[model samples]
Target: MDGTPAAEIVSEVAPRAGETIVTHQRVTGFHASSLDVLLRGAGIDTVIIAGVATNLSVEGTARAASDLGYRTIVVSDGCSAGSEAAHSASLESLGLLAEIATADELLTAVHTPATV
Candidate 1:
């Protein structure tokens, strides 16, 4: 599944319009990815993570982000896992390393423009 199409983002959730999407193959998205360089170039010191495989991808990214000197937050409700139990457990474990919040809370904290 590593080099297959299934490993890529689904067409149903593809980026549209001005949305910027970065795809990474590894568990820790920072390694071997342009994410860290892009973030630094853009002066982005924080990262809000939302993705699948709560225990693996999400956790790995958050940990790597934190280690890379970035403030990382995991949107608990915005992410999904193979099982609800796994999702909840991953959130709990992630809380130790990153700030956990809902999509509503993050939206309230940072307002996005109607058109970007």
Candidate 2:
């Protein structure tokens, strides 16, 4: 699995030098990974998640992150499911636990300066 194409991060989103990468083996990224530890170590309280399987891995991770007390956000357009209904349903359910935003909204929020 380590050497397989499926396990590789695509070039577009590949990690740059000095960036930390954590690998997970369960449906939720935090289940058996260093993600929680790494985030806590970095003093991160917010988590933005984007990936495939809107009804499975994405939802699972979002729920786990929310339950862990992190402010979670799911990029709606950045995730996909086997069908539109499934994706919509997942997002609807996740809305109760996490914030849902489109890629554009996320980018704008990231770029907008915070005012004190």
Candidate 3:
């Protein structure tokens, strides 16, 4: 399988029309990739991460974002792994480092008026 080409992203999870795709071979999205630069170039100070393998890439990316001085938010329910236990456990660990929020809660917060 050494020569086997890496599997490409499937259509279902593919980037949409206007969304750019950033591919990386590392477990972490920020490792040896332009993701951070691309995001910063777009003036994105806050990152909402969601993808497969919650305990691996997603968690790594979220931690990297946090270390990079970004307001990182990992969409708890938006991520998945091989098992529910792993997913929950990873999120638990991730919550200690970054904010863990549901899609609904994030949407509500975005729409809610600021008290200030």
Candidate maximizing lDDT: 2
Leading candidate by TM-score: 2
In order, the Cα lDDT scores of the candidates are 0.88, 0.96, 0.90
Mind giving the per-residue lDDT tens digits that candidate 2 earns over 10-107?
99999999999988888999998999999999999999999999999999999999999999999999999999999999999999999999999999
TM-score of each: 0.80, 0.96, 0.84
Report the CA-based lDDT of candidate 2 relative to the real structure: 0.96
Runs in model 3 lying further than 4 Å from the true structure: 1-16
lDDT of 3 by residue, 1-116 (tens): 23355566657877888999787878889999999999999999998999888999999999999999999899988999999999999999999889999999999999999997
TM value for model 1? 0.80
**Pairs of colliding residues, candidate 1:** none
Model 1 — which ten-residue stretch has the worst lDDT?
107-116
Better of 2 and 3 by lDDT: 2
